[model samples]
Target chain A: MLEKAIKGSKLYWGWIGLLLLGVATGFFAYTFQMKEGLSITGMSRDVSWGFYIAQFTFLVGVAASAVMMVIPKYLHHYQTFGRVLILGEFLAVAAVSMCLLFIVVDLGQPQRMLNVLLHPTPRSILFWDMIVLNGYLFLNILIGWVTLQAERKGVEPPKWIKPFIYLSIPWAVSIHTVTAFLYCGLPGRGFWLTAILAPRFLASAFASGPAFLILLCYIVKIFAKWDPGKEAIQSLAKIVTYAIITNLFFLSLEIFTVGYSQIPSHLLHFKYLFFGLEGHATYAPWMWVSVVAGLLAVLILLFPQNRKSDNVLAMACVLVFLSTWIDKGMGMISGGFVPNPLEEVVEYIPTKLELLITLGVYAAGFLILTILYKVAVGVKKEVDA
Target chain B: MRANRRKFLKIAGLATLGWSVFPNLLRASEGGEGAGHVRWGLAIDTKKLNDEVMEKAIVACHKNHNVPHIPDKREIKWLWKTTFHKAFPGQMLDNMHISEYAEKETLVLCNHCDNPPCVRVCPTKATFKRADGITMMDFHRCIGCRYCMAACPFGARSFNFYDPKKFLKSEEITTQFPTRTKGVVEKCLLCYERLDEGKKPYCVEAAEGVIYFGNLNDPESEIRKVLAERYAIKRKPELGTFPSVYYLI
Candidate 1:
């Protein structure tokens, strides 16, 4: 069915061409980083991780959000999701690929990345993260492909596939939880030490991942001329509304704890992110934008009329996507590092090369997403005819 | 079937014995002969540490280790200097007299925690805690993910963002120690190399009376004596890393 990706309209080829160009440029920047080291990036010794890890964190949430569709379709037997569930699984495949790519690009020794497997330490959260992410990527690919093949043939998926599909539901949660453990289990990082971090990650992931999927459904409707169905989209919008609200509620609880306890080590990180810490507020603007956009998204999504309208729902999903992107991608990792353990604020701003490499990874992910979606839609159209 | 069962029981018994005894044998061999008996520690007499004394110690350690002198935030230092308040942020008090202590420059380095978070978070065991309680790094094995840096509460770990050799002059390079490549995390190994050579760490040698280095497990060691007689405090002690380094305030 990959042949379906090859035989697309001029617009599809053009999009594929653009993505290839992005991959080429990112590879070019990466060679420079390899030669000169991580100096080409904006990370200092103070903020050891920058844009690459942040993007990895955000994309992990996106990957994990496939469960939102998986749970409703498999457990609840919601038939509306049957048409769109493959799209969600494919999105997870792409997102997990991006997550892995972001990690590789961020490494100072990308060449030695296999060492994580070779000299695996069971105690390291990163070690578990590697296991869970790869497991998730594999699960999504196997389930999405096998089930879609059965759909194209107009038969129920084989019995063996059922266990795998059910397993993916919890595996999705494990991927994000392990990613959170990569931060929360660390001793001195005051910002990430919260026990609620995994829950918060899941809530934000559910909101952003589904919101992005809703937008993708619209794109499929226009481009592929196959509606994923309005009922499916509306149900997703409701999921986004509840998830985003939960995300905001979790954020408030974190704030209340930090504010009431008044522990300077913990309080300082929030101060740096929300306000200026010692006159350096690099992320403050971005954080406020995330906060305002999240609240506005919730307000827009709350009403029944807004959910019914395609335009309003799209706007709200975009807001939800943007809001979570900034919160997780921009603030979360850097916030933990800044006002660093010693209480010194060293800012991180991604260099052009870093941003280019990041764009390359995103393009790579989209390229995968496009090809997968093309095959799924092509199969759907064939079966419908 | 009876012969096979007898053989399995013998093999299983040997395996259990090897599991228990081999670890002890391996631990004994790890930091050289009798290294399992030593838990190396440092006690810094901050009151005795002036700028000149601190500089000598920092310079000695850097010179011996071939640590580059990068003059920016990207600078690498196995040992360095900072203010008291910065070193111990959790200990700050709201009084003018206490604020004076905040301005006093104090020496800082890797605490080489007994329960190192860096060791716990390292994906590849590239950074590890030795039998002698010193945290060591194997640069060749590091994937440079920098998770150890995030785990270190002291901000002690430094990633080689650039090829470290570039910053060192030909004359400044120490042939005794290998210069690190870019993309690996490094920090004060607490002079494990010197300890192996039966010599004090270069910093201890340079600032003789100010910094005490000894085997903490030995009750009569100088570090233990210093701890007994002085009011020394370990940084972020509440976090339970149980840092091997202590500061005499």
Candidate 2:
């Protein structure tokens, strides 16, 4: 099946070439970072985690959103999703791989990463995150491959595959939940201390993941000349609509609590992200863009006529993706660290090397997604013919 | 022959279980010695801390530990000075008659919490709580995730963003304690090395009478005596970290 990836059009090869270039550039930057240590990045003691961690947090939600397709197709026997379910699982595979890569690159001591496994402490949320994330990656790979293989053979998938498929539903939820716990369980980080963080993570993940998938479906329509089915795409748009609304609602709840209570520790983080803390307002513009785009996306998605038009729907999906990307990828991490525990405002800005490394990680994820999607689409075209 | 083999297997299984449990039992006994017997603590009298005394204490600890002077906000610090309002945010009221105390410089260091959030969050157990109530770091085992830095409420922990050895002159580097490498989290260990050798922490000795270090568990200890006589407060006590460091206002 990987042979399909190798035999793509000139355009496909060019895209692959660009991605490989990104990977090379990132690798070059990473070597420099390794030699110079994390000082090459913009992180200070006050804001210890920067861009790498934020991307990791955002992509975990994307990885876990594969469950949205799994639940309706396997559990409820939804036939519209049958053709697109493989795409979702493959996306999970790519996203989880990126999540893992981001973590490795972010490490101050990447060589000593095995210490997490060599000396596992059950008390640590990171330990559980490692287990569940790896487990999820394997589960998706096995389930996606076996099922796609059965489809190619025109035979039923093996009975043994069912339990693993069922397990993946909850396993998908666990990946994002544990990632949320990594922040929420921390004692001093008031921004992440809310119990609603896990639920909010799921809501945003369901929105952004499906929104990205909707965009991918259109790309497949143009490039592969394959429609993933209008019904399937519409269903995903509905999921995105509801999930983004829920995500916004969760944000409001956090705001209300912080504003009403008037607690400086919790309120200051919000002030830093939305307005400005002390004199620094680096993230305020990005945060407002997320908010306005999210609201506009909801309005577009809520109307049936607008959603019925493929062009408008695609526009809305892009907005949804951009909105959640900034919310989680830009705001989530630095918001927690800005007003350092001692009430000092220390801001973080990513260096060029850091941004290059980040782009490299995203390129690596897309490379995987491209290959997997090519294989799946090739098989689907063959069966349809 | 069957009966003898079964009996031997039983004994072997019991021995294997005992070997596994034995280390935990030994650890429990070792911890028990200091559990209720010797909880190391410090009490700082802010009134007694002048600029000269605080500077001397900071210099002494840094000299003893081989901590680097990086000349940036990223500099590694075992002990440092900050204003009273900065050290204890939200504790000072705007209309208070003692508003001048808000600007007063006070010395701060690792609190060595009784229940350390850093120990709980560390994936490799690199940062751990000692039986004697000092939070300790195993630098070799650290993977440099900085979760400990995130978990610490007092901003006490610092990550080695750059190799610390570069900032220290060879002659000035102390042989008394090991200097840290790049990509690890470190903080004051409450001078456990000196305490082991029947000596006080460098800051305690340097501060003259401003800083007090002794066993909080011992009723007759000097720290307890100071706490009894002075109105002292711990930083972020509401967080339930139960910090061993007390501040005398």
> Which of the numbered candidates is closest to the native, going by highest DockQ?
1
Model 2 stretches astray by more than 4 angstroms: B1-36
For residues B20-120, write the lDDT of model 2, one tens digit per residue.
97878866765444565788999998888899999999999999899999887677878999988888888765746669788788988899999999999
Model 1, A134-210: lDDT tens digits are: 99999999999999999998999999999999999999999999999999998888899999999999999999999
DockQ, each predicted model: 0.75, 0.72
TM-score of chain A of 2: 0.99
Candidate 1 per-residue lDDT, tens place, B1-249, comes to 999999999999998899797877765555475667899999999888999999999999999899998987888978999988889986866655577788789999999999999999999999998888899999899989999999999999999999999999989898988899999999999888888889989998999789999999999998898899988889999899999999987
lDDT over C-alpha atoms for residue B27 of model 1 = 56
* DockQ-based class of model 1: medium
List, residue by residue over A245-340, the lDDT tens digit for candidate 2: 999999999999999998998999999999998889999999999999999999999998899899999999999999999999999999999899
Model 1 chain A scores worst on lDDT over the 10 consecutive residues at: A1-10
Please tell me the interface RMSD, in Å, for model 2: 0.8
Q: Which residue pairs show backbone clashes in model 2?
A: none
Clashing pairs in 1: none
